[model samples]
Each structure stands twice: as structure tokens, then as C-alpha cells.
Target: MTEHRIITIGREFGSGGHEIGNLLATRLDIPLYDNNLIRMVAEKLDIREETARAVDETTLNSFLAGFIFEPIEESSRLNGTEYVPPLTQQVYELQCDIIRKLAERGPCIIVGRCADFVLRDHKNCINVFICADWEDRVERIAAKYDISQRKAADKIKKMDRERRNYYESHTGQEWGSIDSHHMLLNVSRLGMDRTVDILERICR
Candidate 1:
């Protein structure tokens, strides 16, 4: 029997990362995890999916303000309060747990939320980072969402900032940096199909 391979994809905003992940999953006949992980965390924690998605792997400067020491473990509980210091942390842990459980199930493709860092220790893991030119990304986003170019640019900037900040906070590494990935693809130049083909060869 062949060994199972886990592919973890880290992508930049406005890039066709999610679409490529879906295509790869279909081609490889494996489960694809992107939005579903957020749902699972929300269900497990009994929080709204929107809320879970909002804090997924993200940290706030306010939460880290003026604390030279980490909080006592005993004080960390998921209370139904707006000021809870542990809410985001709990969500992040839940997401990580879900990612681990998914990997254990079989070969799968995981997109975003720093799955590469979470499953780095897995022996058969393939870490891929997807990026594209700013103009190409902006155009893609605009076309996909039927938004103006300016709107697409704004959305891309905000989303990338959130993703970058979240990744840096959790993984202690820069998001979209070459060092974090085994392979980096420029989807704008290679296009989606060719990129997928290259990744299939690399992962195989």
C-alpha cells in the first residue's frame, strides 16, 4: 500500500489558493479542508461560525499589551464575556486539533490558517505556498466578486494583513516567506492548471 501524503497550502490573499486547493483535492481524490475547519471549530466550541472565523489563528495587540508574563493557566477559561483573554487562544487550539485529526484520517489538502506550521512534524507533509503578482491578484479578486478594482485592492490589503498578522503571531514566522514552505508557486505566471500539475508532480 502507498503511504498517505498530507498537503498543507499557505496562500496569499486574492491569489487563487482556495480554488487551486479545491482542484488539487478533486484531482487527487482526497478531502479538501479550508472553510470546513472553521465550521468544525465553531461547532466544537459552540460559538458562532462567523466569530470563530474572525479569530481563527489571529491575535490582538490588546490581548498582549503590557504583560511580561503569560497568564496563569487557571485564569484561562472560555467565559461568555467580551473581555475574555482566552477566547482567541481557545479557538486557535481547536483549529489545530481539527487539523491534526483531519491529517490522521488520511491524505488531505489543507488550505490557510497556518496548517503548514501546525502539521510540520508529520513525516509525509508537503508544505506549499501560493502567491501571485499584485495586479493579477487584484484583477482576479475583482472578477470573482464582481467588485470594482479599487474595492478588490482594498479587500486584498485588509485580508492579507489579517492573515499575515495571525501567522506571525502563532508560527513566529513571516507568512508568504519562502522559508516556511517547501515549494512556492507564482500562480499568475504559471496559471492555475499548470501550477496544479507542477504541484502534483512535486507532491507525488
Candidate 2:
């Protein structure tokens, strides 16, 4: 607890990354941040939760030529009526600030939204990438959401593409690539309980 440990879980959709993170947090007795973060961000910005989530982990394809990027450290991180920078950039900065704040608060698990890249400089942070076989991913997705295998596969492809693009655009690293993470885990091979146990041992 004194070390301010932070775990960032970067995962493929339907790979049980969220479930693993939640279980890990429960076992470790710490907070797990995932989609619930949208509410926090929304409240801070005084915007609708849907509005905040609209840009969460998503990139803006619209052209913004010749715009200078503001350094993250310089962000005001306002909790106000209106956003300061372009909406996408503003949301990104705000999330970055929240992630840093959460890290400083103490040991916790953060899932997705490029948390690994955001806290890349934190000495106490461990970045993990979770993956599984395509079939395993598809099967998990279909079972959890009551969708057909083909639909699940389509969802997996689209989600993976978005995550890759989001990570690369924000962090300049290949998404789900081993080089980007301290550990690359296959939940399909290890199983969820064993995966959590392995991560616990690693963190210890």
C-alpha cells in the first residue's frame, strides 16, 4: 500500500479483461476503473454521461489542421460548464488527469482507455496486455451477450480495430503488441482464476 502500485490492463474486447480486472481489484481490495469512469468525467464536465462517453477511447477523424497540441501537464483540468480545448482533446486530457490522480491516490487497477500509455512515466505502474485466441474471443463474446458467433466475430474485429487505432494515435505504440506492455497474458490458456493468481504473484 505504501508503494502506490498501479495496474493498467489493456485488453481485447470479449477477452474477459474487464472481468479479470474486476476480480483482481476485489481480491486486492482496491478500486477498479473501467466504464464507470465515464460518469465521473461527465459529472466533472457538467455534461451528459452519454456525451462524455461519446468520445471515450474514440478518435476524431475530422480535420483540425495547424492546431498546436497542448501539453498534458499544462491542462487546467477544469470542472466547469464548458470544455476548453477541442472536445476530443479536452476529454483525452481530462481522462489523463484522472488516471494520474487515481494513481496518486494509491494502488488501484485501471482498465483500458489507454491508461498504460497515460501513466507510462509512473515508476510504480505495471502495464499488462490481455489477449486470447480469435475463437476463444468470439465464443466468449457470443456467450456473454447472447449473440451469434458470426456477429461476435464482427464485433471483435471492429472493437479491436478501434482499440488499435486509439492506442496508436495516443501512444505511438502498436496495440496489443508485446513491446508495449510489461506482461502479455492469454486468459484462454491460463483461465480467469489462474490469470488473476498469476497477476497477483507478479504484482507481489
Candidate 3:
């Protein structure tokens, strides 16, 4: 049997990362695990999908600082704390587990969630980071969300900040930095099809 190709993509907000992943998955005839990963985790863990989405691919904030100091075994004791919810840690762990399992299953494209770091040891893995110019990103977000350019830009800034903090906090690596990925592509430069072609070639 041939080893499956695994591609992990990390992208700046509104940089067409999800679209690229979808296209790549279609072109390669593999599953695209983007937001669906969150849904799967939520279902497996019996948690609300919204809760899963909130923390999905996102790092815990200072709000979780106190809990991290507590022993993992004793985490259940703090179930009722006003600052932390019982399912927070459970959801996070389930998400991580799902990511690992998906990679083991076969060829797939995983977008976001520090998947590159999670599967760093997988020999067949190829990690790519997608970014674009601020203006281009703003335009993409505006069109997708049907909001004004200024509002879109603001949303992009906020989302990217959260993603960066989440990635850095959990993986201890710089988000969108070249060091974190095998290839860094500016989606604006070559567009999605060319980017996918480039990645497919590199992975091959």
C-alpha cells in the first residue's frame, strides 16, 4: 500500500486558505478537514458545536492561566469555577486527538488548528502557510462577509490576532512565520490554483 500524503495548511484570516484547501482536496481526491474537524470533535465529545468552534484552532487566553497550573488529575475539581468551564479542556483535548487520528487515517488537508505542530513527526506531512497583502485580505473578507472594507479589515485584524495568539500559545512557534512551515505562499501572488499546483508538486 502507498503511504497517504498529508498536507497541513496554516493561513492568515481571509487569505483564501479554506478555499485553497477545498480546491486542493478536490484536485487530490482527499478529504478536506477544515471546520468539519470542529464538528467531528464536538460530536465525539458530546459538546456543543458552538463551544467547539469558540476554542477551535484557538489558544486559551489568560482566562485559562490559573487552570493550567492545576494538576491534570484535579481539573475535575474546578468544574464549577466561574472563570472556567468543565468542557473547555475536554473540547481542546478532543480536537487535538481528532487531528492526530485524521492524519493517521489517510491523505487529507487540515486547515489551521496548529495541525503542522500536531503532526510534526509524521514523515508524509507537508506544512504550508498562506498569507496575502493586507489590502487583498481586506477585499476578500469584505466580499465574503458582505461588509464594508473598513469593517472587513477590522474583522481580519481581530481574527488574525486571535489565531496568532492561539497558535503561539499552544505551539510555541510564530504564526505566519516562515520557520513554522515548509513553504510560505502568498495566495495573492499566484492565486489559489497555482498555489495548489505548487503544493501538489512539492508534496509529490
**Best model number under lDDT:** 2
**Residue-pair clash count for candidate 1:** 0
Off by over 4 Å in 2: 60-84
CA shift at 79, candidate 1, in angstroms? 17
Off by over 4 Å in 3: 60-86
lDDT of 2 at 91: 70
Score residue 146 of candidate 3 by CA lDDT.
96
Model 1 bad stretches (over 4 Å): 1-3, 60-85
C-alpha lDDT of candidate 3 relative to the true structure: 0.81
* Residue pair clashes in candidate 2: none
For each candidate in turn, the TM-score is 0.86, 0.86, 0.86
lDDT agreement with native, every candidate: 0.83, 0.84, 0.81
RMSD of 3: 4.3
**Clashing pairs counted in every model:** 0, 0, 1
* Residue pairs in candidate 1 whose N, alpha carbon or C atoms collide under 3 angstroms: none
Ranked by lDDT from best down, the candidates are: 2, 1, 3
**Weakest ten-residue segment in model 3 by summed lDDT:** 62-71
